[model samples]
Target: SQQGEEDPQALSIQEGENATMNCSYKTSINNLQWYRQNSGRGLVHLILIRSNEREKHSGRLRVTLDTSKKSSSLLITASRAADTASYFCATDFKETSGSRLTFGEGTQLTVNP
Candidate 1:
């Protein structure tokens, strides 16, 4: 119902496998960002991709943004048990008032060793 809403709500995977989470937004965004949060911990910024960029990478994490579809995706390669956390997608909107950031519910990723 909000600007940024993620799909699959939850994910289960092996330690060596990969995990992917998708987010869809309603309005145009200046940029999109992904964040990770361990249980009972504060969120950590994962990556950020501007509207002009199609894809970006940081270590084992890859992010892709599609402006036409108003969607973005995050892929974690060689996921580990330590990577088990909640991943959220945030959209940055530059409005007449100012910039606004909206976060999705997030996808709970459980990595089994």
Candidate 2:
């Protein structure tokens, strides 16, 4: 079963702007991580914020989590054309599920040059 999925399949942005996306899950989880994949680049880990945490920030990226709602949000500040890529959210399930980062379909982001 799909554990986590991001909202809005795609997003287009200007050279210098902020973009936000949300992710929702189906069951209780151990932790959730966000990743970014360029058009032809490997998916790189962006952040990993646990269920117990509410929010986290790294550089221009801000992430928020709401365990009660089984949801999370990612905010990218000062967008650039290089930021154009697909973003995905993944989660580590409970003990019985094993340690696997199940990723979502992803949200395609376009930053116009």
Candidate 3:
């Protein structure tokens, strides 16, 4: 099963500051991915960290995964008002049918100007 949940369901931050979100999962996973969704918009893939990797980064985003703990964390540096959105962590695992992806409840981020 690919079940996960994010902490601090909601977060408030100011422009130019850094925002961090944590996610924890229940079962083993093949890889984990982070996504960003603007209000009424489709999800944007941020980064993907494989089970063998510990951390990865792209632009202003950094993702770290801990397979032993079944957890992950995402950090956004120099946040902007435009960065305000809902961030979700999705876990990917292999099943009999095929690979499955399950997303967490998500963390609502509000970046102030």
For lDDT, candidate 1 versus 3, the one ahead is 1
Indicate whether candidate 2 or candidate 3 has the larger lDDT. 3
- The parts of candidate 2 lying over 4 Å away from their true place are none
Clashing pairs in 1: none
lDDT of each: 0.94, 0.91, 0.93
Off by over 4 Å in 1: none
Report model 3's TM-score to 2 decimal places.
0.96
Summarize candidate 1's per-residue lDDT along 49-84 as a digit string, tens digits. Answer: 999999999999999999999999999999999999
For residues 10-105, write the lDDT of model 3, one tens digit per residue: 999999999999999988888999999999999998899999999999999999999888999999999999999999999996789999789998
Task: Report the Cα RMSD per candidate.
Answer: 1.0, 1.2, 1.0
Instruction: State the displacement of the C-alpha of residue 79, model 3, in Å, after optimal TM-score superposition.
Output: 0.5
TM-scores for every candidate against the unseen true structure: 0.96, 0.94, 0.96
Clashing pairs in 2: none
Pairs clashing within candidate 3: none
Best by lDDT: 1
Clashes of 1: 0
